[model samples]
Target: MKALSHLNKYLLKYKWYLIWGTTFTVISNLFGIIPAQLVRYSLDLVKETLDIYFLYNGSRLQSNLYDVFAFSILFYGLLILAMALLKGFFLFLVRQTLIVMSRHIEYDLKNEIYLHYQTLPLSFFRQHNTGDLMARISEDVSKVRMYVGPSIMYGLNLITLFVLVISYMVSINARLSLYVLLPLPVLSVAIYVVNTIIIKRSEEIQRSLSRLSTFVQEAFSGIRVLKAFVREENSATNFTVESDVYKQKSLQLTRVDSLFFPLIMLLVGFSNVLVVYVGGQEILTGRLTPGNIMEFILYVNMLTWPVMALGWTTSQTQRAAASQQRINEFLAVKTDLVSEKSLEREIAGEVEFRNVRFVYPDSGIVALKNFNLNVKAGETVAILGTTGSGKSSLANLLTRMYDPTDGVILIDGIPLKEYSLTSIRRQMGYVPQEVFLFSETISNNVKFGMPEMPQEKVEQAVKDADLYQNIIEFPEKFDTRIGERGVTLSGGQKQRLSIARAIARDPKILILDDCLSAVDTNTENIILNNLHRIMENRTSVVISHRVSSAKLADKILVLDEGEVVEHGTHEELLAANGVYRELYEKQLQAEEV
Candidate 1:
């Protein structure tokens, strides 16, 4: 029961269901005791009437012995039938109430975990793998439900039946009741020892399973890489290693679970032997009758099922405890990011960064240092940088994906932290260097940011991205299903689709971070031409390595090694003879070649 303390709140919330379910289970077991009692009474009646051919009724009316016997059998048969029906009805209620409550709790628990996942900072996700999270919510959740539902119901049933049957056995013969009770203490100790091992082993099995799931998920995600490298054999070997680890852990858990039932059976066998040995002597010594012996045997037999169930229930309870501990670890993690601001207003798209500095957690390298930028409303600022020059870090800060370690970022003259996260994020449309699309229809992907966006707006967005001609070529047009991560679409098409999705939201600020790198130069020019009209009076920040992409910007800032190196208009940067000029000359040489 201590193992179930983690679920106490849920249990208390559904306390009424537990109460009613247990009440019905107790009632069902009470009715279950009747058949054994009736069998004993019938045998005693037979013994008493063996010498009489006819019996005298209370009114001195002689009745045939056959009729008397028939009447008694018929009366007890109906009693047993009625009790059986009642037991079945109550048992059904027990399952319906408690099991359904467990399902409801499972749903609520999963939703809470998912909500917590959403609240956690980006760094938390960077630390946890997708497959491990999936395993916690899926497999571990089901395991907890087993403890909440069937294990609980069966446990209640065993307790109720054990009490009633043991009481009846004691009343029939106190000495024999003592014999039956002898094995129970040893059985309890065995359960305690075996279940301790079960808890540890179940945890190991769950962790191993999570590793295997992660391996499979990663392998499938990188199947193309494996195929391109012709490394299927290596991947198979790695998978076998992980699979073997999981198998070994599962076998260890099974070995622990396998010990409980046999110990219970041995104890039960010893109890039966005691019952026969003790009861036969009592009957022969004229202290007990044959009918009394039968009654004690029946009661002992009734105890057997519950004793077996005790083992099973104990096993399930330990497994569920192991799962509960795992889930609790996730729930106990406090979210690093907290939203305290209540401001929710339309953004005017004026952006500024003042002496902003940032370093990623556990990394000594700085991503951004003393970065300063101020873009007035309706200005288009382009950022030029090489790999690892903090281009994406700026976009991440603007979107509030990560907060600056030092200095302030302001939106519309207000501190970024003063605004609600949702309001700030909703006002910005970002297209990252690595584009991701859901496995959905093209129209759905386009409307992903704003699901209720009008169809006409979706069409206009696609047209603006210069993707209309390519999209209409598909057999299903806007309704075409792009498979996982939009794999069926070319890299350029995926980038364009990502742009359309952002534009469809009609955000106040548009941040494009190297989104056009996948498109050809000719296509990039066409898209830029369309963007000129879209960028009018819209605060936009474009990050790219291409000089051609920055030519139309109101300002261009060059970054080298996480610090701003130079800043000017495109023409001015070209004449500055700095990092920007060097990069421009190299691109020109490569293109000319």
Candidate 2:
């Protein structure tokens, strides 16, 4: 019912179309009743053994004598043709208008869902499958569109059939018509009971279908990894299981669907047999006439659709319910942190951490505790740490990806929470440990941060990142498509592309999270030298395990076991003969050996 209600809101917007649609439905029924009445009158005329006086539709045309058989055939034929013309004319317009409205609903819903997904915080994506999210936006929204179109049309058609049939039945012989409708309650109950099962099964089928779609999407996206690992058989087997599950669920639901038509036929068939047996005796005993029997039979035909539509409407209702549930689930999700706070002034890059403590949700392991640091604007800082040393978490706090649990991270002496998320991130040009480029042209990827960039700006940024020469070397130059995740490009080139993309924005502060590890030492040095020129009077934070990169910064912080164990200039850290010295000596020894 909830699914039906949501669909109704949109359908009601075009009420006049449905109004005319239902009115035309009744018009079809009116024409449909004419053939049975004509047959009975023609039979009565023949039985009386009198010359059949035909008005020829009141035109007084001679259609009589030896041509009576031909006249009867032509009369019914032309009536059927006229009925068909009326039915098709109205049904066509109704179908066209409904489809247009359904398309509008589909377009609006798909765009809105996609936009909502974009605005949702990062954690929402982290806990959900990418393919599942896609299914909710694509497949489920389409289900709603299908429901909105045909289900409403059919459901209303059923009501019109009921009203038209009952009116005709009561007008002919109220007492006899009442007896014919005796089987209706039984038929209704049967439809109701069977429809419940159909609805339940339909939901199961839809869910299994989404799971299969997700599996296929994931398989395609990660095909390269599977092939590289020689896991083709494993992937195929997994996909087959998902597909088979989908098939079984669809078959099960359709099995229920198959039962519906047969049940309606049986019940309606039983009613027909009863009406004919009883109505025949009534006519023979002078209690009724052949005309009444013929009319009842026509009414029975009218009843067929309502029974058939019960099955279709049941299926559509169930799909809509499932789609609504999925959409509701997405709308309910809320992110733990991040906001858009408006401030009167712009933020300078000076960053401070005061008594910062952090822990991940599932893994309650403390990644940082009582972390404190203060760096002034225009000063370059480097962080050296082993794996899982909370260096990345610290950077995440500065970018406001995750907030500290027990303390404050500040920018320019203002709490991070006080600054708008956009304002905070706009100041920092961050390059993650793993570089990713879109499956788009190199120029488009480089200019991604500032898409409306001038050609000169894009070219200059590429040059500053030391990637312009490499891009021009390609046959298609910067317009060449980078394969998925920049797979077609070398690791060094990918990192430089990431650098170019980040540099294109011309941010006030830049954070490089060991993002240039793939480049040679000489190349890394040159990139760093260029970065220094760009970062002049601008803050920059370098994070790397490589000592060569650390030497470029004016100050360094060495972290161990979620704690900052050392902080100083390169010479000061070497003089302390602690963690930084040990790390420096290890690199030197590795080169010498």
Candidate 3:
């Protein structure tokens, strides 16, 4: 009952639909039951007129038995035709309403879930794979719809059938009706046991299925990499392993599923047998009429559905409960990054980091420590470091992707937390070391696939990135579609396009994390020179591996092992005999060799 009570909450929005649907079902079934009753009643009326034929000592029929039989046949045919028409109309009506309700509920819930994902921190995505989350939105949500719309309608029909059958049975013989209901308790117990197993197994099956899908997606996306590495056998083996787990789990679920209805039928079979046997004896003893016995059998036949439906509903109820619990668990994890609770406002380009220390949510130690820096309203600061020295992590802090564990970041001398995330984010443009591009047209990629953007603005951004000339050489130019992750583009092209997309917004503070790494030094110089022209009077952070790249910056900071070891002008840092001097001298020596 509590499970049903929980399910009703989702159904509350569709109360009017259920009310009209159930009413139609009841009316249709009333006409349906009439024909069965006519057969028994017509036979009883014939007993009044037939010849002496009771070898078992039954009463003879009265006069005009053939006319009575003919009238009953006509009424039965008319009742069936009327029932068919009513049932068909009800089918059309309920289907239309349920389809609308299902679509509305699906859309509303999907939007809410998507918005929830937006509010969660980046750590959430790191902990869960992209494919599994996609499956939940697509496949799992569809299952929820199944539970909501049609499941409810069929459930109502089953209940209506049960109620009508019981009322008619009471009219036949009260004591015998009680006897026919004897196995109902057993039916309940069986359903409870089977439902528990199905629920537990279904959850396992769903988890395994998600994992299998994730593995396939990962493999497909990295197929070129796997082929280049000659890891096809390994990839296939890994997929096979995942697929096997899903297969076994699904079979275990099916094993449980196949037993649900038949086993319930087996338990309820005795009642069906007992009704005919006991009701027939009552008739022979002159305690019940033939029509009464026939009516009782119809009622017995009707109990089968609710019993079977109870079993199926039991499984569906548990699935919905499990799904809700999983969704609740996801929503319960508090986000580490918190935005401003107040109004959003514009931000000035000035940024300051005071003794900032950052620790990744997954790591035990700080990735950036004791960092102190300031960028004026319009300045270019370049960061120099070896791999794993927290270059990209520094840029991430500016956007508040992860807040510092110990220190404060300020915008226009106000604590960054004071400004809403949208306001703060709108002022900064970032191009990561690992460039990510969507599958879309070249123009859409430049626009980051924004549904609406000025065409001239996109063209300007592409020109600024120095990719406009190359794009025009492609077969379709601006209309040329990019593949997933920009697979169709070269590494340098991808990085340039990502840079173009970020720059398209005309941001106040721009950060490039070795985004020019893929291009040749000559090409890199051209793009950087172009960026300088466009980013005039704008605050910028640039990270580059080549020592020559730092020469264009107003100031340079050298980092090693997450600590800022040296900071000053490019000339001053080389004279300081610190991390910057060492890195510069090493690159110089490599070029000489």
RMSD from true fold, candidate 1: 2.4
lDDT of 1 by residue, 2-108 (tens): 55697889989999999999999889998888888887788878888754544454433345566777799889889989988998999999999999989988998
**Arrange candidates by TM-score, highest first: which order?**
1, 3, 2
- For model 1 the local lDDT of residue 451 reads 87
TM-score of each: 0.95, 0.89, 0.92
Off by over 4 Å in 3: 1-10, 49-68, 449-451, 589-593
Full-model lDDT, candidate 2: 0.78
Cand. 3 TM to true fold: 0.92
The C-alpha stretches of model 1 lying farther than 4 A from their native spots are 1-3, 54-63, 284-287, 362-364
**Candidates' lDDT values, in order?**
0.87, 0.78, 0.77
Instruction: At residue 557, give the lDDT of candidate 3.
Output: 86
Better of 1 and 2 by lDDT: 1
lDDT of 1: 0.87
Candidate 3 lDDT, tens digit per residue, 173-280? 787888898888877787778788887887787688778878888888888998999999998998888888889887887788788778877866788778788888
What RMSD does model 3 have? 3.4
Is 1 or 3 the stronger prediction by TM-score? 1
For this target, which candidate reaches the highest lDDT against the unseen true structure? 1
lDDT of 1 at 182: 99
Q: Model 2, 147-209: lDDT tens per residue? A: 766776777678777887788778877767777788778767876787688767767776787
